[model samples]
Target: MTAVSLVDVASHLPPERVGREYFERYSRPDDPLLRNPMFRAPEYRRYAAREDTGADLVERAAAVLFERHGSDLAGEIDLLVTHNALPDVPFLGSGAEIARRLGCRPAQIVDLHNGHCAVFPYMLGLARSLMRDTGARTALLCTAQTAGRIFTQPGVRRSAHAAVPGDGAAVGLLRASGESPILATEVRHYPDHAPDVALKLDDGRLYWEPGTSEFDVAFDNSKAYNIIERGSEIVPEVVTRVCERIGATPKDIDLLVTNQPNRLLLRNWGAALGIEAPRHFDTFDSYGNLFGAGVPVNLDHALRAGRPAGGGLVVMAGFAGAGELAAAAAVRLPGPDRPATPTTGGPR
Candidate 1:
């Protein structure tokens, strides 16, 4: 059985100036904030709502991944997998739109619509299954989140929603290879608390009520709060299982990528595991939260930008709405056959 390694990764962020200035200009000194010191400054897009559509972001990023690898988009890929919660339109999944833009045929596309945690694991599992069953050679995996639409709702607390989320997309090429096969993957689901962190359809629009309230009556459940508390435990447990299956300790991990919710959650989880802080490749503070795209986006950023490169174990963990957690580990393959090159593509 051949192992799977991310052959190439690419990401796109909406223009980074508009939102940054808006926050700086309006944010108060006393507002509750979770600062991510790893970033010298926040990364964000200005007027992302008006500037770019969600499908546009995904297509642009995928174009870069193909160009960087010097692979022919039409010939190289046997399958395409997309993960997103808030897709561009109600009826059409983002995967189909991406495939259409890339000129890929209907037979080549599959859509996985789950929250943040569901995307990567679903893609990984699909790749593994395809390799075992159909002997497919290459697959394109993409994840994107356009939280701008969610946070821009009238009356929703923009400070809380906008502070953490940023719009972005990540794309990766996964191929069947003998060298770096995916070792182990584990996913934990906590359904009893499903209502805690949920996106609901109110009237005709989508609404996100992060936390529950006790006070009066309607829609006052603290689901978001419960998700955080339970997530603390879920993340550690999932990581432990992945480490044990792979016969590696948390200390042995060279890089750990967790869902970019906030700086505080990352720190708390790092402390809980007694692992020194791994190089945090975060886009959340600047981009806000990219929902399902979090892990792939971070991995793409770390790989493309310069980082200490040698063979070491890397962990990718995802935690999304409703206390769902997915964890997987891969040994960073020795640097590519040739030094990596910058991707040439249009603005995403």
Candidate 2:
């Protein structure tokens, strides 16, 4: 029996509105990427409001979930796991602070720093395993992407890739119940690509060391090509493996959601798996690249819009940080037209 299922998802996007004009001011029409069909200027209008200027994005998102579900849901969480690509506090994740602010005293707390964009499934896998092993009923998983804080800098903003990232947070509520049950999941890590995604600075100072040189993505042409190919391949690979685990195929999934890096990867993954555009969910045109929060945010978007209908099979799949980690899962979505209140579940 499945131990945990994603009962619901809620997202918090900042109030600020930025547009393609924001990036166009720095980049020119002659930019090679502008002409690439695969490339699209990030038109995400929201910013998480420079690091720490307001309530944490994760907190805001979770508050929405609790408000919609009930305050009691906050008290029921047994485990809380958080993944933020850019942590406001150095040497400390925002998990403890978030839990504190939300009035949740979880039995366990995890502040994961890696797993990147694909960490959504990784967290889901971790939640189910822990819930089963510890005899717990509920878990809260939170992911935030604040890449805009760094990308908006004068030094880095000139590059086109700088505009690819946006800011927001999405938190999912998982319970040990059949409501929105998770069917099967697969997670993989490749050490060869672990070092491929990195930060570059011309001054040769380590990221931790004090330096005046601004940082940017270190990807070169060879690394970029290899990463793109691996990304185009690995995501579908995991999705297929997951579907096959449950005696189905990607064709059986009613809706597909993945990290919204850009149009290139999105189109490639669907084409590779034969999933059509209508059945696939995308937020790139409005939300840009949301990093780890991308998938959950999209899931929340779909649910709020009353999409994929009820009793549908949905698949969430993507790779994280270059191509080092990938994960996918098959889920039986909740019924009756939209996300519903969760039923507390535990050991059978």
Q: Pick the candidate with the highest lDDT.
A: 2
Q: How would you encode candidate 1's per-residue C-alpha lDDT over 1-348 as one tens digit per residue?
A: 666655566888766544555555544454333132322224564225555666788888878776655656556677788876556776777777788787766346777775465467557766667755766677888887776455444433224434445677878776676444466777766666655544444343423344442111012225435555676777777777788888887776667777766565677678777766545455555555566777877777766655426535667776766675455544454444533233322112
lDDT of 1 at 68: 57
Q: Where does candidate 2 stray beyond 4 Å?
A: 28-39, 51-55, 337-348
- Candidate 1: where are CA atoms >4 Å away? 16-47, 106-108, 157-159, 199-221, 335-348
The count of backbone overlaps in candidate 2 is 0
* lDDT, model 1: 0.61
User: By TM-score, how accurate is candidate 2?
Assistant: 0.93
| TM-scores of the candidates in the order shown | 0.80, 0.93
Candidate 1 lDDT score at position 22 = 55
Worst 10 residues of 2 by lDDT: 339-348
